[model samples]
Target: MKLSPSVSIEQSETGLEFINVASAKCDAKIFLQGGQITEFIPKNNKPLIWVSKNETFQEGVSIRGGIPICWPWFGNHQNPNWPAHGFARTSLWQADEVHENDEQITISLKLPMKQVNTTYWPHQSALKVEFILTDTLQVRLTTTNLSNAAFSYTQALHTYFPTSDIKNTTVDGLQGAQYIEFGEGPFTQSEHVSFERETDMVYTQAAVQQHIHTPDGIINVSRENSSSCVLWNPWIEKSKRLSNFADDEYLGMVCLEAANVLEDKVTLEPKQSHTLITTISWA
Candidate 1:
């Protein structure tokens, strides 16, 4: 492990790397390999994120929890054999900037196109992720097109939140939105969402803010420039098949992702850019 005043490089027993942070209103741990945040705990509040105690933390492997960045594309690729969630989650990122102020601390990391595999994304683009560590953690991910032509893709800030119990927790503020899961009906959300079994719903034209009513309390998840969000919990059997995840871990974790999918996918012209932002706080 290597240490700085507010940040450090920590390696798991398996030799996976992580950038541990404590510069601002919260403590965080981000993996340098993926620039993926695996942990964040704001002062005076309970831990909002959760990871498996049995996580393997192997290098070049995606971490099991916190906020995973799904870029360029999400889910299964058109080629079928391609990676499930694009390359950003497995690529190494450079820490381009780090700043601290009385109000907050900010860390910026950029993934240069040269470091990415052309087979996954043949376009010239620059991807950057900025994290504002404060009492309420804020994150912004930006993508800039460097080529003359246009490129389009869907993405998500696939964030996982901790809960006392999945069945007892409900996600409100999605009422009236439209959701689809497993080729099911384009169901209209007429009430708050609660879990009974496995869920993998993707909601489009969603509201900017939502509330997670966990046994601990209500957590506010707010988004900007986002029209879609995903609600997922791979309850029971599926949990046993996940990597670096415990079989019963689904009981304590739920993903409320800020996303751009289907109609909300982004298309950027030459030199154009798009940013998706989200903020979280406990009430």
Candidate 2:
């Protein structure tokens, strides 16, 4: 995958390169000193998550959704052009702008109507994604509905956080909120609580932020305008199937995603917009 230097390269003040692979479409690798990936990797199969290492993260992370502008439908419901998660994550997006400060690097990408065919989404829309990597990581995705009618869609940051143990971890955020547990069967909202194994849940109307208590330190997730939160750790058996993820790697990570799904879909009128913001800080 040869990305033209003109198309997909940005740098920090210290000269650390952020490789943006537009063809991989949803892939990004952040390289720091000694070429470490201090983030996440996109598995070829899922384009989400990565193998977790015990040390500090080596890769930056993958952005799973665009401002993933899904229209008319979401999830898997027999749509040809628009797949289960939406096309924004898989479609080619142009690098629009880049900036660097003393402490962080920010890169912006744009997906427009001219950039993509609006067959599944028959409207002109502008999707902008900004990746701000400072001491903490802040990812913001904003979608503007440029079309005439109102549009509704679901979105997620789908973050893969590095940790030490799945069993010894607890996410502190949705303590009193409601969540849809996917552990046994269909979606059902229950009281938000701690985890043990294979905990796949969607907390409804959750707080804008959450905290993961790992042995090393706490990773706080702060967000805005996103009412749903997802907590998942895919145990062992399921981990082997992923190419980019190592088996038993589940022991070193937990996923706490910021989402707008099902009951909390966003609707925008012509030229109106909505923003999904997520900030990951270590303490």
Candidate 3:
């Protein structure tokens, strides 16, 4: 495969496959296992995505940060033993296409449906993820139902963003949206969102865009075909329970996910398709 200066196939110490990119404007690292992006840095700005310092690049295991693809299901599954965020993040993906210009590189990967576990899925489906790494980062996840019956699922681009100080950071553009935290009631967001303690909230009727104000600068996050979003910071306890995360690591990162979950779950009829898109940029 002839790739640009910004793109190449690399492997982790444990033999995990990844696409490494370094362009004139930015740099990134993407894993082929889940079509997951583990790093994105635009020019002189700080890292827009964050990975756990304690993370071990192992096979069939989801990495702790960057943007993890949560597909088919968003959270804890009905069957508790099943994977929390579906199997996509742990499954291998086939790189199907690659396109590059002078300033940007785009790579596409497709899920191997024949090898997928049919136990959870309904209706024949097709899954694809694409990453466009330029000065900014853009991701697109597409799903198509090829069967005669309709099917539904929840999904998200579980994006982890870095912060100089988590407590001082605030997220904007979510005023008036309703959210639920820890299975609580539908509360409304009256102001820009900020974190203090352990925080996990899912917002409904969300706007198409939001902004994260960190000490360094503002990062813009925009989404398409998604009316729901999730915000999470372990703050303390849950961080200890996570496999690759440190107990105090929550203070350095925040998860502002672009999601289609709960009331926003997507249902597709025969031959129908849906695409969820998210873009991130920092100046």
**Number of the top candidate by lDDT?**
3
- How many clashing pairs in candidate 1? 0
Each model's TM-score? 0.96, 0.72, 0.97
Error of 2 at 203 (Å): 1.1
Give the whole-model CA lDDT for all candidates, comma-separated. 0.87, 0.60, 0.90
Off by over 4 Å in 1: 1-4
Ranking by lDDT: 3, 1, 2
Error of 1 at 247 (Å): 1.2
Cα lDDT for residue 215, candidate 1: 95
Lowest summed lDDT across 10 adjacent residues in model 3 is found at 1-10
Question: Candidate 2 has what TM-score?
Answer: 0.72
lDDT of 3 by residue, 213-242 (tens): 998789999999999999999988788899
The model with the greater TM-score, 1 or 3, is: 3
Candidate 1 residue pairs in backbone clash: none
- What's model 3's lDDT at 37? 93
Candidate 2: stretches off by over 4 Å? 1-82, 115-117, 183-193
